[model samples]
Every structure is written in structure tokens, then in C-alpha cells.
Target: MDIRLNQLTMQFEEMTAVDRMTTTINNGELVSLLGPSGCGKSTTLMLLSGLYKPTSGEIFFGDKNVTRLDAEKRKIGMVFQNYALYPHLSVLKNIMFPLRMQKVPKKEARERAIEMAALVRIDHLLKRKPAQLSGGQQQRVAIARALVKKPKLLLLDEPLSNLDARLRLEMREEIRRIQQEVGITAVFVTHDQEEALSISDRVMLMNAGSIQQDSTPQQMYKKPVNEFVASFLGNPPINLMTVERMEARQYKLENSAQMVLLPERLNHERVRVGVRPEDLYLTDKDSGLLSGKVLHIETIGRDTMIRLKIGNTSVRALVDPKHQLQTGDICTLGADRDNIHYFDCDTGERVNVEKEAQGDADTADVEEYA
Candidate 1:
């Protein structure tokens, strides 16, 4: 089902939990609500699932107004971090519970429960109780139960969080596959950026009761709307450097005596440059735009994370594991002009060099990363 939140707001005492949030989620699209704790992501999910009534505004499920609807009457299925399955009930019985609550015929509910169990690949474990299953197995059963009702919408609240790292990956793939096969409108809530990026059709990044950015995972990572979104979405995060324009096409570090020639297209007089760790290439000498001393190196199988100190600023760069580098080594970091991100230091807004030069600085800032 297509879901829309129109000017939604939720308040507790004097604090706003969700502030005038508005967004439309199309049918069959798996959208993720991603952010840190206390960011209102979970609150938004509860509102959509009709578990919490919004302090103001309206919610629509297709053409029906569901803002005041009861949780069970919303035709929404929910799976929580704990799985919430009845320990005494068999997998098949747990899957059939929702159907039975709606007064589905006994024989038909059983058939549908079996079908859903098979869909989530838990049919063979149908007779097992929640206590007899592994974390992943129990989660699969929960998914099966949610799907058994053929709900118009499915809400997942950090469903894979309880599993170990490997199981989290495995279940993420399973969830994506099941969502595709069933084609249900899904809203997945998670604080893990990697998990959301890996499985969501679109991601909604939230902060302090407001939506920060909403876009494809690739876009959100590459072209963040502001410093907060940029720094929050990436592993090792984006490298930030304070800079001042020395002259036309020339810029210098704000805290250092070092200066470098800038690309002709860049026109920001005073700004901060943000470069992804992957975008930086390390060199032996001061031949690049920035020079630093390597402070630490972390080897993680396929990739190496190198930490360097430039003046007083510390930056991390992701390099190949094969690169020979050690602590205390001096290195130069360079980024391709196309990969460099410019943000106004004072406003924390991205600087659009192309638009600034064309005298049209009012264009909407690009927020998604590629």
C-alpha cells in the first residue's frame, strides 16, 4: 500500500519527537528509517504502524485516512528486535495467530501459515517452538508470521539486530528476497547505515525529530545535504579540512602554512572540503594537496584504514591492504577534483561552485552520494 505522512508531528510534554515530518512511500518500496538513537526514527515507525497517535497531522494508506486508526485495524504487520514470538507456541501456530485473530477459517489459516513458513524457508521448523530455534531461525519465524496475514504494510524495527555479524548479513538477504517476492510496502527501522544501505530501496535519514535526507543509499552516501548527513552516513566517515582561498584558484589550510592550487571550477573563498576515505590516494612525498604523518594503520582483510594527522586535523584514508605503510611515515593525500566536496564552513551547507560561478547560487544542493 502507498503510505503518506502529511505534516506529521508528535510531541511529548514540551519536546517534539517528530516535527512536521512529511514523506510519501510508494507501494512495494522497501524504505528504511535510519538514524542514531533519539532521532525519532522509531517514533515515526510507530506512528505509521498506528501504534502511536500523531499529536498533529494526517496519515493515509492509499485513499483511506488512517491517522486515528487502531494499531490492529491498520492492516499492518510488525516485527520487533526481540522477534516477540510466543515461546510456548509452535512456529506454525505462531504464524497462524494473526490470521486466527482476524477470524480466518481454521483450515484456510493453516494453509496460509504453511505457505508463509515455506516462503521464509522455515517450513521444516514449523513444529519447533521459539525456544528450540536459533536467533536467525526465530527471526525467520517472526517474518513468516508477519507475512501470514498478508498485511498491506510490514514494519520491521531492527529485526536483524539480535543476530551475530554473519547472521545479520544472511538474514538481511533473506528479508530483501522475501520483500521482493511478496511485494509488500515495507518500512524498516535501523540505526546501522550499512544495513540500511545494503537492503533499502530508499533511505530516510533522520535527526532530532526531523528528516535530514531522503534518497537512494548511493546518493545519500555520496552527496549528503550537509555536514551532519555527510559525517553520519559513511564508514570511517568523510575527511573534513578547514580551508581559505589564498587567491583565484588557490587555497590554503586555515591552520597550516601549506597552500595548493584549486581547480578552476571551484570558487568558494572560505569553505570546508570533505573527501571520502576511498577518494584519497596516499603518496610518499608532499606532492599532493595535503601532507600528513601517518599515525595508525588498521588492516581488515581486504582493505586497510590509514589514519594521518595534518597540522592539528586528523583524517582517515581507506587504502588497499597491499599498500606498504607504517606509523610515523609522512604521506601526501590527493583527491580528484570531481570527488572533492565543498561546504560553507559557517552555514554547514554545500558550496555549489558551478552554480556560484554561473550566478545562480539558489539551486537546491545535491544531497545523495553515488
Candidate 2:
């Protein structure tokens, strides 16, 4: 179930929903298409499922060209955001619908349906209708129905979006377990960054009808290709600062006397620095790189987020919950040299600054715990 999209473009009227998207989804690997709303993730899913023919380029499922294949003929199972279950049909009948459509014997279809239902943990609810099940149960039914067909490729478009916060977490884990058990290649579409990072082996981030970056979740977060990818992947969002390169390893912070030092000199004179909220550590004002006043403090369970105003710029830092910091407290924030990221100011591309005499940059400096 390896899929390759070669320059796949889907255009509707004057708008191009997907633009020259090319990527490979390896066999038995679950990859998530992650992006904001209207970023073409869902449209890409539609193209892959054969609901929309590509305006240009080709799609290959392994060695077979499936660009012109019909939706029903592609052997692709799709689970929509709304679940799209038949309210009038019983759970068993719904799960067996695909097999029934393929002219399988009633007894065989029933047996296979029962197995799939159990795999998704919905076997006991088979006698009930869609209306009788809860949201989570209904979603399980949808998954069972899609998987009962034993599809080679499974497409899930925000399957957990309709569930509650807790239910969404539970269902996502169940989906991952079922996908692993079936060993099917899955393409999941989701706008939630956490959900995408938590379940998928890799993530394809899309924006404005174009593919932003495709990489393993860890690589996508740790070594982002651009500002958009970095900003989109984080929960509290990566802190961005516009700064000027003073000399070799020195960068003058905007509207402040604070300075940032990297291991090596950047190729660009003007750059933007990116630091994650968790990377900014609170220290003594005299020892920190930047001094700021705490504007607000929020304690959300285990982590405390402190909003600070530094050098005419506002930044948020994640601190230990036990830290005795208040709103009026003056705090100094410092970022580890390896944790700081620099991008070309104009182009918004990451500037790979090499360590002096080292020839190349080292990523091992910052531990990739997150």
C-alpha cells in the first residue's frame, strides 16, 4: 500500500486546492496531512480517494497508476469527519456493507464484519443502530465499517473532530491501535498539531494549496524548514524576534540592550530568531540574556506559562508550576545557544549557521525531549 503523488495538482475553477504536491506514503505507515482550515489537506485526501481527478500529474499506488481510477474501484476506505453512517442500518449491516456490495456470501460477510467490529471494540454494539450509540461508539462503528473491507489504503479526514476533548483522545489512540493491528497504510487529515504529532509516523504540513514540509514528527518540530512550519507545529507557538547580526556570533535584540550569541556566525546580516516557549528559561536579571516584566501567569496543571514583556516585544515562557512568580515580578529570560533558531529575515528560510571551524552545525546540542 505504498502511495506516490507525483506533482499532483487539483484545480477547481480559478482556485487550485492542491499545487504540485509530491510525496510518498510508505506501506503500512500512518502519515498525517496537517494544516489549518482551507489549507488543502482535505482536498488532497479527496484526490487520493478518487473523489476528484487531478488537474495535472499522476498518482501511483505502488506501481499501478490510480489517477484515473474511480472511487469505488480504488479499494480505498474513507472515514469522513461526520462519520457518515447510515442511521437506518444496524452496526453489523453497516460494517458488512462493503463486503455485501462486492457480492461476498452473506455468511462470510457477517463473519468478517464481526471480526472487524471486535478489532475496533464495537462488536457488542452490532445489534444497535447508529442513533443508539454515543459519539465515540458511532465513530468506532465508522472505523469498523471502513476497515471491514480490509482496504489497502485507509483515509481518515478528521475522524475525531466531532468527539469531546476526552473522547477525542481516547478515539485517536484506538485508531492508532487498529491501524497498527491491520497493518494498513493510513492517511489522516487533521488541523490539530498535537493529534497529528501524537499518532502519525510522519506528517505532511500543507499551507495555501502547497506542501510546506514533509518529515517525521520529531524532525518537523526540531528542524523545521521555515517559520511557517515552526509556528504551526507548536502549541503555545514558537516565539519570533527580529534581530540584527552585530558581528560574528553576536545578534542585537530589537529595542533592547540584550544580545544573543550563537555558536557560529550567520550568513545573513539581518535575521529572525525563533525560540520555543519551553526553551526560554527564567533566570536572574543580571545573568539572563533578556530582561522583562511578567505581565501574566497561568497555571494549567503541571506547567506554568508566564507572559512577559521584553524589549518592546511580548513572549511567553513555560516554567515549572512551583516557581513562585507573580504578575508584577521582573524576570530575565535566557535561551540556550543550541535552542535558538535563526531564519533569513526577508526569505523566511532557516539560516544554517555552522560552528566556527566545525564546518557544519550540530543538532545534538539541544536534547530533543519534546
Candidate 3:
């Protein structure tokens, strides 16, 4: 089932939670409503599930307008973050509870419950109560209960938030696999960027009750629409340096004499340079543009986060963990000119800079900041 929100707006007493949001979710696509807290992602989910009627706007399940439809009548299955399961009921009974409420015959309900339990890999725990199961297992049961009804749409609200890191990873994959196997339209709400980027067919990044960017995970990371989207998507986050125009294609880092070569077409007197931590490469101190003293180092598996000080500014770079570097060691980092995102200093919008042909491109026309 495809979902559509047209001019969707939800207002509180004095504030708007969702502001004129318009988007289309295709059939069988598992899209994620992703953003930090108070971004209206949850409100939009409630609206999609028919729990909260929009203040103004229309919603369609395929082609049928159901903006004012009640939650119970939406034909949608939902999973909550808390794993709201019945302690008094066994796993099988919990999975069958939804059908039982609809007056499904006991035999048929039992069969369907068993089928869903197996689908979620919780069939072996059918006789256990909610309290007797692990966090991941209980979550599986909750998912089984939600799916047993075979609703046309499935909505998950931070469904893996309550689990441990490993369990969250495991359950997310399970959810993706099950969603594909059932061929149901799914909307997963999550504040975790990794969670949203990993399983979603496409991500709808939200902020201040508005859509920032609705695109594939790769696009959201590589080509963010604006400054916020660019800064918000990465792990260590993109390194942003405020540079002032020096002369022609030259720019100087703030409060320093470091010079950078921007695209020849860039005419902005002031722009922010955005480069991902991973895009930074270690180079000889005298040859690199941004050389500094290492301030901190954090190792995670095969990757290490190196924090360095360039003049009065702090910069982060993701480098190979095997490249030995101590806190006080001098380090220098350089990045491809084409990899940097130039943003307008005044509006925080991306400023396009045309790159030179491959044969004429210059990657290291820079000098370290004093």
C-alpha cells in the first residue's frame, strides 16, 4: 500500500508540529521518518496510523482519502518502542490477541498466531510469557503480534530503542527481512542515524516540523540539501571551516593565514567548507594545508577518530587505526577539492562550485593556517 500526505499540517495550541508536509511513499517501500526529538516525525507517524488527525490536509491510503479515519479502522499494524505486551498472556496468546479481539475463530487465530511467531523466529517461545523472554525475544513477540493481523501497512516507532547495541542491530535486520518477505509498506521512525540509514529504502530527514531531505541514505549523506542536513547525517560529523575570501580563487581559514584553493567559478566572498572526517587524509606536515597538533584520539574497531587543533578551530578526521599518533603529535590532513561542500555563509545553503576537468584538476593547492 502506498501512503500520501498532502499539505499535512498539525498545530498545537500555540505551535505547529507538522508544517505543510507533502510527500509520497511508494508501495512495498520501507521508508523511515528520521530526525532528532521534537522534529514531528512521531506526529507524522501518528497521523499516518490515524491516531492524530491533521489540523489541515488530506491523507490517502493509495487513492482513498482517510485523513480523519480512526486508528482502529485504518487497517494498519503498529509496533511501539516500549514493547507493550500482556504479561498475563503467553507468546502464542499474545500473538493471537489481535485476531481474538476481531472475533476470529479460535482455531484459525491459533494457526495464524503460530505462523507469525515462526516468521519472527519466536516460535520456540510460544509458551513463555512476556516477562520470561529476553529483550530481543520480547520485541520479536511484539512484532509477531503486530503482523498476525496482516494489516495493509506496518508502522514501527523506534522499535529497537529498548534493546542493547547488538540486539538493536540484530532486530533491525530481522525487521527488514520480515518486511520484505511480507511485502508490506512499512514506515520506521528512528532518531538513530545508523538505524535509519541501514534499513530504510529511503529516508525522510525531518527538523522543526519540516522535511529537510527525502532521499536514499547515500544521497542524504553525500549530497545533503543544506548545512543542517550535511552536519546531522554523519557519525563524527562533517568538519566545517569558516573561510573568508582572500584573492581570486584563494580563501583563508578564520583567524588564520591558511589558504585554500576553491573552485575557479566560486564568486562568494565568504563560504563554509564542509568535508567529511573520512574524506580527510593524513599527509606530511609541511606539505598538507591543515596541519595541527593532535588533541585527542578515539579508537573504534579498525577506525580511529583523531581530533586536531588548527589555529583556534578544532577539526576531526577519521583515519586508519594502525597509523600511530599520540595526543601531542603534529598531524596534517588534506582532502580532495571536489569532495568539499561549499555553503553560503549567510543562508547556509549549498554554493555550487564548478570543478575543473580531471586532467586539469588541482587537489593540493593549499597552505597550512598560521
Candidate 4:
């Protein structure tokens, strides 16, 4: 089912949690509401699930207005950060609880519960109580319980936050698989950027109770609308450097004396350059963009994070673990033109000369083709 929020707003006594937010979620799409804590992601989920009435505006689930609908009437299957399983109920009973409440026959409910339990790969633990099961097992049971109802929309609020690192990874894949198999519209709330980017069909990045950017994971990561989206989406984050355009198509570090000539297209007087850690390569002093001393090195098996000081700025570069470099070692780092991102330092908006030129060329080509 497709979901649409039209001017949805939620306000506390003195503060607004959701500020006139509006967005559309396509049918069977796994959309994630991602932001920092208290960013209104959870509030938006609750509004969609019909747990809280919006202060104003409307919510439509596939053309049917559900803004004022009650939670049970909306047919939303919700799983929260806490498992919320009943202590006295066995896994089978917990899975069956929702069905039984809906007045489904005992035999039919048991059959559906069994089917869901097996779907989540927890059928063997049907008789185990919540206390008897591991964290991951309990989580699976919670999911099975939510799915057994076969709700039109599934709402997950940090469903994997309680699991350990290994379990979190395992459960993330499981959740993705199950969502795909069921073909249900789902809205997932998470503070973890990797989690949101990894599984979501599209991500809605929120900030200060407003939607900052809503797009596919790859678009949000690669072509972020602004620096906030860029810095928020990547691991180790994008390296942002303040630079000033110098004479002869050259740019100089604002704080440092190092100067390098860039492509003629990048003649902006002042700009912020963003480069991913992986985009930077360590090279010899003569071949590098700027020379710096390594301040720290963190080796994580397959990749190493090298922290280097360039003039007054600190930068991180992710290089192959095989490249042996130690602290206090002098290294030069450089990135290709395509890997470099130029942004307006004052506005934080991306500045793409190539894209603009390509767009103009495409328009001219279309006119000629016509």
C-alpha cells in the first residue's frame, strides 16, 4: 500500500515534534525514516500507525484517509525498539495473541502462527518463553508476531537496536528478506545510517522536525543535497576542506599555504571541497596534493583509517590495510577531479560545473534531435 502524508504536523505543549511534513511512500516500498534522536522520525511513524492524531493535515493509505483512524483499524503491524513480548506467553502464544484478539479461530490462529514462526526461522522455539530465548530469538518472535497479522503496512521502530553487533547484522538481512518476500509497505525508523542505507528502498533524512532530503540511498550518499546529508550518510564521514580560488585555475587551502591548480571549471572564489575517505590515496611527496604527517592510524583488518594533518586542517583517508604506514610518518594524499565535490562554503550546497554543462549539452542535443 502507498502512504502519503499531507502537511502532517505534531506539536507538544510548547514545541512541534513534526513540522508540517509531507512525503509519499510507494506501494511495497521499504522506506526508512532516518535522523538523530528526537528528530520526529518516531513521531511520524506513530502518526502513520494511527497511534497519535496529527495536529493538522491528513494521512492517506492508498487514497483512503486514515488520519483519524484508530490503531487497530489502520491494519498496521508495528514492532518497537523493545520486544514488548508478554513474559507469561510462550513464543507460540505471543505470535497467536494478535490473531486471537482479532477473534480468529483457535485452529486457524495456531496454523497462521506456525507459518509465521517458520517464516522467521524460529519455529523450533515456539514453546520457549521470552525469558528462555536469546535476544535475537526474542526479536524474531516479535517480528513473527507482527507479521502473522498480515497487516497492510509494517512499522518498525529501531527493531534491531537491542541485538548485539553480529546479531544486528544477521537480523538486518533477515528483515530485508522478509520485507521483500511479504511485499508489504514498510516504514522503518532508525538512527543508524548504515542500517537505513543498506536495506531501505528509499530514505527520508529528517532534521529538526523537517525532511531534509528524500531520495534513494545511493543518491543521498553520492549526490547529497547539502553538506548535512553528505556528512550524515557516510561512515568515517566525508572530508570537508575550506579552499579559496587562486590565480591560474589554482586553489589554495584557506588555512594552509599549499596551493594546487585544479580543473579550469572549478574557479569558484571560495568553496568547500568534500572528498570521501576512500577517494583519497596515499602517494609519494612529489605526487600528492598536500603533504601531511600522520597523526593516528586505526587498522581494521581489511581497511585502515589514516588521520593526517594538512596545514591547520585534519583529514582522514581510508587506505588498504596492506599499505603499512605508522604514526608520525609523512604522507601525501590526493583525489581525482571526479572524486572531488565542490560546495558553496556559505550555503553548503553542492556546486557541480560538469553536471550543469552536461545538462546544457543534453538540452541542446534534445532540441537538435527534435
RMSD of each: 3.7, 3.0, 6.1, 5.0
- Residue-level lDDT tens digits of model 3 in 1-370: 6888999999999989999999999999999999989999999999999999999999999889999889888889999999999999999999999999999999999999999999999999999999999999999999999889999899999999999999999999999999999999999999999999889888899999999988777667766767988998888889999998889978888977677767778798889889999999898765465888899999977789999987888999999887889999988888876678888888887777655323212213211100
Clashing pairs in 1: 218-369, 219-368, 219-369, 220-369, 222-369, 223-367, 223-368, 223-369
lDDT of 1: 0.87
lDDT of 1 by residue, 127-243 (tens): 998999999999999998988888999999999999999999999999999999999999999999999998988899999998998887877776677788888988778988888
Regions of model 3 farther than 4 Å from truth: 284-289, 321-329, 354-370
Q: Which ten residues in a row have the lowest lDDT in candidate 2?
A: 357-366
Clashing pairs in 3: none
Q: What count of clashes does model 4 give?
A: 0
TM-score of 2: 0.93
| Weakest lDDT window of 10 consecutive positions for candidate 4 | 358-367
Error of 4 at 76 (Å): 0.6
Cα lDDT tens digits, model 2, 30-60, are: 9999999999999999999999899998999
Q: What range of 10 consecutive residues in model 3 has the weakest lDDT sum?
A: 361-370
Clashing pairs in 2: none
Estimate every model's Cα lDDT from 0 to 1. 0.87, 0.87, 0.88, 0.87
